[model samples]
Target: MNESTRQSSEPETKRQGLSGNALGAIFMLLSGLGFTVYIVLSKTLTEDVHPVFLAFWRSFIACLISVPVIMRAGIGKLKTRHPGLLLLRSLFGTLGFTLAIVAISADFDLTFSQFNAISFSRSLFVTVLAAIVLRETVGIHRWGAVGVGFLGVLIMVVPGVFIFWAASGGDGFSLDLGTMTAIASAFFLAFAIVLVKSLSAELSAVALLTYANVLSSVLLLPFAIYYWSTPDLETWGWIIVMAGVGFVAQYCYISAVSVGDASFISPLDYLRLPMATVADLIIVGMLPGMNVWIGAAIIIVSAAYITFRDRNKKAQKVKVLTDR
Candidate 1:
């Protein structure tokens, strides 16, 4: 508590914080890469299996994978007395995955620029939802960043509709409903993330994942039943790959945030944009041009700005309450 002791501890604390951040960043980076690969592989398999069916089965497999682990940890320990909130979180999580992956598989060949542009909208959605649903406050500065981000979206989108590809068709394959669904996936995922954060103080990350995946799989079963298609050997191979790798990526990501500050860790999620872009360029020969980067840059900047402001506001509130 003395000056000399506190001064000596400052450097040590800072170093440890930085080290933790670095480790968390590496896990996030790898998790992002795994998810990027999942998207690519999902695209590769869309020729055979519907994305809805694919998402459902993969989630089912993930549930199976996580069960033994959850049981080993003691399922009784995982169960919170609060069941309703857990159900809502799982429902949102399920909708997010089912809609997003299905949309991606259906429209993997859409303009990457527009695709990425729509992806950016999720940050804005999350910010707005945080205010409305979580009762979080937002000030003018963060709102300004949201506006600038949307302006960048217009820049990327306007040209695609009127440019070279316009001659091929109206909107040049822009305005696809699947693209919008993917964007909705981002919104739902963000909201689900916020819920997960709220629950983190009460539940272990593994427990939350176990509940979410299993419940989501159950919710999607009706859809899967309606669209049932027997998986051939080729389809089975991709589903297994998607299930295994996607589970790894998803678990790593959830664990990353569980062990670190969300404000510090969430920004690393943006790394997926570049990873997917590069993978598409290398594997599928889709070189996303300036528009993708420009729009994505704007979105990433805006999302980071929003998170930073929120964290500061939250810390200020804590300080105020503690002062009283």
Candidate 2:
């Protein structure tokens, strides 16, 4: 094998047994679980909590918790110090989060699996957005992969409505404002994630996180007031859990992204379904039938292909820059 072949083969070889890999995997899985629980909890309220209120409170908690850590790191280390970009990130990320909550409130609402599918679409969006924003070349094979991913979304959604209609016997297609909002949330979030990832290169993860939360909390204070409802003790408890878990999940998730090649990691991203499917079955007594399973399979496969292509493209670009 050539040097490049040998280099690629070695990472595969090192994973032959359990090393420290278990710890990272465990943390990642925990992170996933935490985020999933947050989604499930959010969906439990009967509009008892407004979307804006959820955003403000959750972000407020995150910012409050993050402040001490940021201080300990000193003012300079809090972030990369790009004010313009940080400002923009905060604005866009807040908008994304706000819109996402609105969408969730409007749609099928959240389950563990559904949250994963929607949040993970961010990765897919990054690929397509990068092509446009950066003017990067997109190969046909890459476009084909994007098409396949969308096909999977269609599969999951179309039959979903039909299944609802059938379940009702003579009702109608389950097209509602909430469902459409959920779909739109998925689309916009994908774009938001791409923007965040781009800015990530120039910012500290904590900084990126802190600004988004703090600024969002500040910006949302006025709007969140109108929708504020008296959350019961149970609701408050869930909010606390959601805030804490969300912080931990993002922290560890960023760590995972740092250590592993997204190409390799992205494929394992498919494992979200199995994890969430199991969670949903246990928590909500809902197991996906054959249709959801098939659709998920297509999405997983396409996502893997897209990640592989993106990594290869990125590597080539880095190589050219280094050679220059």
Report per-prediction Cα RMSD to one decimal.
Answer: 3.7, 5.2
Estimated TM-score for each candidate: 0.85, 0.81
lDDT scores in order: 0.76, 0.67
Please report the TM-score between candidate 1 and the true structure: 0.85
Which structure among the candidates has the greatest lDDT?
1
Instruction: Give the per-residue lDDT digits (tens) of candidate 1, residues 212-301.
Output: 888989988998898788878977987888889899998878767756687988898887877777776787677665555666787788
What TM-score does candidate 2 reach? 0.81
Which residue segments of model 1 deviate by more than 4 Å?
1-18, 106-108, 111-117, 157-173, 318-324
In candidate 1, how many clashes are counted?
A: 0
